[model samples]
Structure formats: C-alpha cells, structure tokens
Target: MTATSISPKSSPDRLSLSELEAYIRTIDTSEYTKTRNYIGGSTQLSEYISRGMISLPRIRELVLEKNSFSASFKFLNELAWREYWQLTWTAIGDDIFDYIRPIKDTVRPAMPEAVINAHTGIVALDAGIRQLQTTGFIDNHMRMWLAGLVCQVAKCDWKVGAAWMHSYLIDGDYASNHLSWQWVAGSYTGKPYLPQQDNINTYTESLQKDTYLDQGYGEIASMEIPEILLETVDVLPAHEATLPEDTVTLDGLNELKNADTILLYSPWTLDPLWRKQDKAIRVLLIDPDVFSNGRFSQQVIDSIVWFAGQVADLKIICEPVKNLEVLTAAIIRKSYPGITTWPGIVDEPEMLFPEVPVAFYPSFSSYWKQIKKYSMTDQQSLF
Candidate 1:
C-alpha cells in the first residue's frame, strides 16, 4: 500500500527521526523524578521509542550529552525499565500473560463493565481512560493507577485488562504493557499495587475523596470489591484491517535476488538507517497474524505505514516472513515471542547495559543495580 493511503486522521503526530531527536533535546530531565508522577509532566517520547523511530541507546546518549548522569539518572532509569521488561519477556515468552508468581488474592476472570465504559466514578481514572481512547496516550502514573484499579480494586484478570489497554495504546509493547499489568496484579511483584485516594490526589492534583479508593492501605486491602466493579463486561475485540492482496515490489528486488542479505523491517524495526550501505532487498513485512493478535489501533497502523515510507526502496509486504524464505538471508531487530521464522541475524536492542543478564529480575531494583554497575563506567555514544 502507498503512504498516501494512510489518512492523517488515523495517525498521531508524525515525527521523523531527526525531528524526534530535536524533541528529545528539548526534554528537561532536571525535575523529571519529582514531577513525573503528575499528569502531563512526562517527556511524552514513548510513542517514538516504542515504534523504533528512536532507539533507547540514542535517547540515553542524547540525555547524557545535555545533562550530567546524576541529573538525568531518573529519566535514564525510566528508559532502562523498558529494556528490563523486554529482557524479562525474552526469558518468559508467552508466560508473561500468565502469573509469574502465585497471586495472593481473588481476581475476576473478566474485565469490569465500569472500566470498559469509563464510568468507574474515579474522576482522574475516567479522565485518563477517555484520553487514552481519544489520543492513544496516557502518562505512566495514570497507567499505574488505572492498572491498579482494574486488576487490584476492580478484581479483573490482568490479561483481560492488559489486552483492553493494548488495543488503543500507540506506544504499546507486549512486554512492557503485559508485565506492568502483571506487576499491578501481584503476579509479577510481591504485592498488588493499590493507589489510595490521597495518592491519586497528590499525583492528579484533584481534591477527590470519599471514593472506594479513599482508605488506608490496610483497609483497602481488606475492602470488598465495589458494586460498580462487581459486574463484568465483554470487551469487543479489536477490528482487524484487510491486508493488501499483493505485496508492493521494490525497485531492486530482481537485481538483489541473489544478494546475500535482506533487511526485514517489521512494526518493531522501522529504523531508516538499518543496513543502508548494503545492497539488499529492504522489505517492510506486515504479517496479518501479527496484527490480528497485536490488535493495534488504526492510528498505530497508520503511524507504522507512515514510518515505513521514510526509507528508500522499502517494499511493503502483507504476508508472513516465512513466505519470503527465497531471500538469501534475513536480518531483523529482536521483537516479541512471535515473528521468528528464518532469522539470519537478530540484532539486540541498543541498551545502556548490553552485557546485563537476561534472566527475569523480580524487581526493577535488582535489575537497576546491574545496570548501574555498567552504565557508570561505559562511555556514551551520540546519534
């Protein structure tokens, strides 16, 4: 499909890698940790990072170049958390949807209707949900609060809530999204994250009180599921778009048929500069199965299509990677559990601590300790 086919309405703000870098340079990390808990206090660079328009290594390098590590450590830590989740996902695979550890409390099998309808009576949370539905964006703190409300207070299954959230998120990554939900559900962490009314008030700047969340931690732990959250609702499955019948032919496919390398760009790896010097067939493969299961919104799909347009001679393929086995060799950026058919080269994500162990670390503290050991001594690289 042509880039012109993707309507601007279906895409979020479209920024090229250079434009994204300019935006990144403008981020003020001085007060990030102190103000990040409040809505609109974040850098809002997640969509670019998640979509691979900007890499983690580049972000870390850029931030460090502008500010001292001490000043930007919190922001860098946040970037590292994304890497930690990805490494954890690589270790566990599909098991991330299941409980990593036994849950201590009851969890409803289905999602609550109140959450789906955005009428949970929690003003800050409902506002966040509405923002998510409209713009496919939400701050991290609101995300935790929403997750806590859905998986802990609402008592819904974490997977169910996670899938609902993933459907609309422009920055949704299975590892980060699912694992965070599990963390809130007490499946990945030692305890479920329960946000009290005061906590919400402090972060959201709302004077809301007397809600079900307005209670002591002990009282909240012992409280029964609110009547509003007692009933479950069926979340309508995300609509899948029809793929093009024929893949677009690249300009050099015939001449490069005998070439030893082919760069494959999936939704996860749309890097414009990947293997630019090599004479290879560059294909943007969009597997129907991947999108079907991913349930990505039209906006996210549009953004992907737009990003793929940036690369010269990049052919868009609608079928699975397995169909392209005729290619001499394939190279791709490592992604989720699936998308592994004939991987000639799997490039690891550019991480701050590339040498850190990949085994699942139960807590970010455990993972961060290992990261700090290497990040402190490593020389920084700029994009």
Candidate 2:
C-alpha cells in the first residue's frame, strides 16, 4: 500500500491574536446549524482550540458578542463537546486510552492497510483519509465516518486507528481524539457507529456506488470484515528530528534561581498571556518522553516551536522536568496524564461548562443534562 502525497502547504502556521480574533468574528453561527453535517461545513477552529492557542471561554465570549446565544447554540454546543471530552479525560485520567467499557467483540490488532494508503476504494472515506494525512484537517462528520469505518467496518482496534489519526491531526487533542474513537467503537457508547453509503453521499455530495459500504445498515451491520480491510498495515508517518535553534539561553534561567515562582507552559498551554501580569520566570517545557510516546509529526513540533516564539522570555526546554537542575516553585496549567511535575500552583483551565463537576457521566447526554440549565447564561460574565 502506497502512502498518500503529503502537502507542506497544508500545515497549520502560527497566527497572531489579532488574526485569530479576525477569524472568530467572521464565523456565521446561522450557517453552522444548517450545514455542519456537510464535509465543507465547520468553523475550522479546532486547530486553534486543540493547541490551546485559543481558549473555550474566549471563543464563547467572542461568538456571543456578535450572535445571540440562542441563535448560536449549535456552534456553542460543538465547543462544549470539546470541553466534555476533556472533562471526561480528566476524570478517567490514563484510562482514557483503555476501552471505557468492556468491548463486545474483538478486532484486528492494527489499522487496515487500505486506510493507511488512502486507497480504501470507498470514494469519500479515502478522500477523508487523504485530507487528514495531507492537511492535518478533517470535518467532524468525516472524522466520525472514518473512525466508524476503522473500528466498525474494518474491525481494527480503535487505539491503533486513533493513534494513526492523532499523529497527523493539526488539532490533535488526546482527550478528544481518543475518547471519540472509543465512542464510535462502542466502548463509550452502546452500539458501534456505522456509516452507510447513502449517508456519506448525502453529506459529502458524492455519487459513487457499489463500494463495500453501499449496502443497507442492517446488511452492513452483520457482514464479515471485507477482504480490503482484513490486511493490516502498521505504518506511521516519519518525522524529522530537527530542534529549534533560536531559543532562550539557559544562562537567563540562573537569574530566576532565587525567584519565588516560575510559570511553566506545555504544548497544550502555549498562551502568550498566560501570566503576563505576574513577575515570574517563564518556561516552556517540552518533555522528550511525552513526544516519544505521543508520536507527534514534525510539522506539529515546528508549529509548537513557532507558538513558543510568540511568548516573551519563554525558554523552551526539551528535557524531562526531573532533569532540570533547579526546581523552583512553579505555576502550570493542568495538562493530561503522564505529566507528574509538582507545581506549587495548578491553574484550572477555562471550561465551557465549568459548573459541571468533574465526575464520570456514563454518556454525554447525561453530562449535558446537568449543564443544560446554565447553557444559556453568559459565559464571559461567569469569569
């Protein structure tokens, strides 16, 4: 199986706050509700949200300033979905990688060769995979369709497919990517999410027929794994090993040795104004071990470095937190599991639904029920 062509132009570049605000203002909330299911329909803001380049509260505030909350509920709901995934991850911790519930059936150990090569012969699915690899972007509908194809139709393990997608997604949030795959795989939900050809045709505006998924939902539900999907492919994209040369010198860190506090930033917390008011040393920690396990692409790494460049006096350290010589009292935005650093101050990130407690809700509907009462409240006013 041959890999699809990678497009360098598709990589997400650094955007200034003004640029981000400009994009936010252009978002038409009315169009979002009517066309969100279509492949081309989306706010295209996930990349900004996933990298913590923008926060959920900021987006909600900006969206509400231009559109009424009632009119923009669909767009706000999508953002809340992102928050729900994160809250679920924080509740479950490392267990997010594991199946949330017992798997009803077993599947292949790895991703299907056809999916990796983007030659699944199913027109829309192949195009979505190609877009994901080449551009690191895909609409929410296509994401579900592709995940369902892998976990349900191809019968591959969700982790295998989820990891492959995460490696390429520009907005790859572990909480969102991993949990949504579990949802589609029937680990987080009752039934596997299967996408039929007609549904694909309706959303993608394609007319191709007689593919493996061309059958009715009942027929496709019980069919054996197709021959095309049976062949396993364990290939992951290769990333370059280049590190940023223009970085803050370690010499400057010596000045902060006696300082009372230091502000730490992770790849997920690249906010330039994180602690602008505080008088503290700023450090952006890039633990090599995290990347070794997460397997982010070179483009992702470069984009992160670009983000770090935006923050004033931010020193980018590649080693583990334990390797640092002086462990000053540090303040850090809470990150995902595997970050075991003992920071003196852990700042709670702004959540779309902060009123909802960080407890396990068996399903998203149940979780939403708890937050629905406050959904119409002005989010910025709550801060």
lDDT of each: 0.75, 0.76
Cα distance off (Å), candidate 1, residue 378: 10
lDDT for position 57 in model 1: 85
Highest lDDT scorer: 2
- What residue pairs clash in candidate 1, if any at all? none
What is the lDDT for 234 in model 1? 64
lDDT of 2 by residue, 1-383 (tens): 00111111222454676678887987889988999999999878887777677899899888777887777878888887888888887787889899888887878778888888888888898999888877778998999999999999988899988998888887788989999999999999767899899999999999989988999988888899988888887765555545444334455545556556777777778777677788876767777766655477666676667666667777666666666545555555545433535454677787767788888787878887778665655643332
In candidate 2, where is summed lDDT lowest over 10 consecutive residues? 1-10
Pairs of residues clashing in candidate 2: none
- What digit string (tens of lDDT, one per residue) describes model 1 on residues 71-93? 78678878878888888887767
Off by over 4 Å in 1: 1-12, 240-260, 326-338, 372-383
